[model samples]
Target: METLANLESFVRSAEQGGFSGAARRLGLTPAAISRNVAMLERNLGIRLFHRSTRKLTLTEDGERFLTAIRDNLEGLQAAIAEAGGERREPAGVLKVSLSPTFGTDHILPLLPDFLKSYPGIQIDWQFDNRQVDLVAEGFDAAIGGGFELSPGIVSRVLAPAHIIAVASPAYVAGRTLPLDPAGLGELDGIVMRSDRTGRIRQWMMRNAAGEEMAAAPKETIVVNDPAAMCRAALLGLGVTLIAVPDVLPHLESGALIRLVPKWYADAGPISVYYASRTLLPAKTRVFIDFVADHFKRQRLAERFAGSLG
Candidate 1:
């Protein structure tokens, strides 16, 4: 009979792609992980992984074994955690990825109350604009927009990710207001160069009646960060397209004004993403529910819709 430790070592090594990576996740030494895997292979009389200086790949039998035991392993671990009273009191390092501006302005404010409710949970949050590989990087969850959903990942829509044209009150004070998306070309446009594609992004603006027109800004001032673009617009540099959530405070305070109130670009949903597992950690499960509830309570979805006139 294979020991549970041997099975765990094998599974984690396969998922992480090497003994060293598995050791980091499981808090075991790489040699210990390797020994356990070797012992498991010896007992089963079959090789599990093809080892090399550069990489580790699973053998055919190993792949089949991993498929059969992966879900069961997670379930077993979850069950053990539950038996040890973890289900009643969720406790762990809750690692989450978030966009810097939105996470600071919105999600950070909710942490106090969450911490109060779950004293056992420790938060390890990474704030960055780039999309992250959740499984590869070992994140418990991520909150952002425009991430491609990879295999074994799931998302819950938190809000509409809507982009709208905005300009500072000073910039638009004497300029002729644009009637449609095509008129936006006349203004000096503050735009963003895509970090992933290295190109200036184009917006396809839509009206209330579902009419679509493309807006290609003049690209007078190019920026990378959304907040920086908003700041540039605030300095009366140019008109810029930005997400509603990123510019809501400015709009509300009269620092920035909407260029075309009826026009917006649908950028899809701002979502909370997590690994799709049969048995999620208690901390992760509660955190997801808490965030969703908070969004609903605050009417953030409506606020982020970019529908304000």
Candidate 2:
């Protein structure tokens, strides 16, 4: 197959009627243009030019080849320019993977405004708990936490993934509020078991003053999913350790209150992941920027920090 450079050079030389003129247009030396055309001719096993000192003329085969490739060449150039992030009108199906709960709570709400601003782009968002293979699965972007970074994947931290103890007001109505993490051991725990290891999940809680302790609540109810555990907590089943985003609405609405407020379990970060930082498509880049901007503008990091309580 001929390279893009060779095809471009041959077409440019044919259009200009001389290698020197093509070279000037393409910002290449005349010798470079001639070599590219020659390489392309060899690759195609046909002579495309009748070369002379004064001018370049197309051979019979060259005329047919030029006609066939002229329109296609313009399309290829447009595609290349778009791929290089030169697209003014970004329009395409943006396939993104997101954690179900977090996606619904956080990113999904921004969709109406996002779609309003970018009417050309269509969203194909998948809400799942499992970590998706971004490049292998052909995803444009993903947002959540605990994604194992593969080669070419990059993450931008949007908020602190802090697991704070929360229980519905009805559950904790008459019960004494705990002043520390260890006091959680006395409460009925709506704990989650790891689906991967089939083991009970435990956390080491930390505070802003560098204090660390175990937050092992009584294993009264066990589930495999964080969302389930969160639901149980909200239902007034028991106190559970959950990420801030999962219960931010409830916390704000006075449905659930933080227990042992000064301590939280650090679960890395909630990040927006993509294939590359510099070579991202326009739609993906803007989405990442939009999510990050909202997170910052709303001060989600500070609000999500349980240690400050």
Who wins the lDDT comparison?
1
The alpha-carbon RMSD values of the candidates against the true structure, listed in the order shown, are 2.6, 12.3
Best prediction by TM-score:
1
Q: Write the per-residue lDDT of candidate 1 for residues 89-183, one digit (tens) a residue.
A: 88888999999988988899999999999999999999998998887677889999989998779999999999999999899887899988899
What lDDT score belongs to each candidate, Candidate 1 first?
0.89, 0.85
Please give me the total number of clashing residue pairs in predicted model 1.
0
Model 2, 29-112: lDDT tens per residue? 889998999898888899998977778899999999999998898788667766665537667778899988889888899999
Off by over 4 Å in 2: 1-87
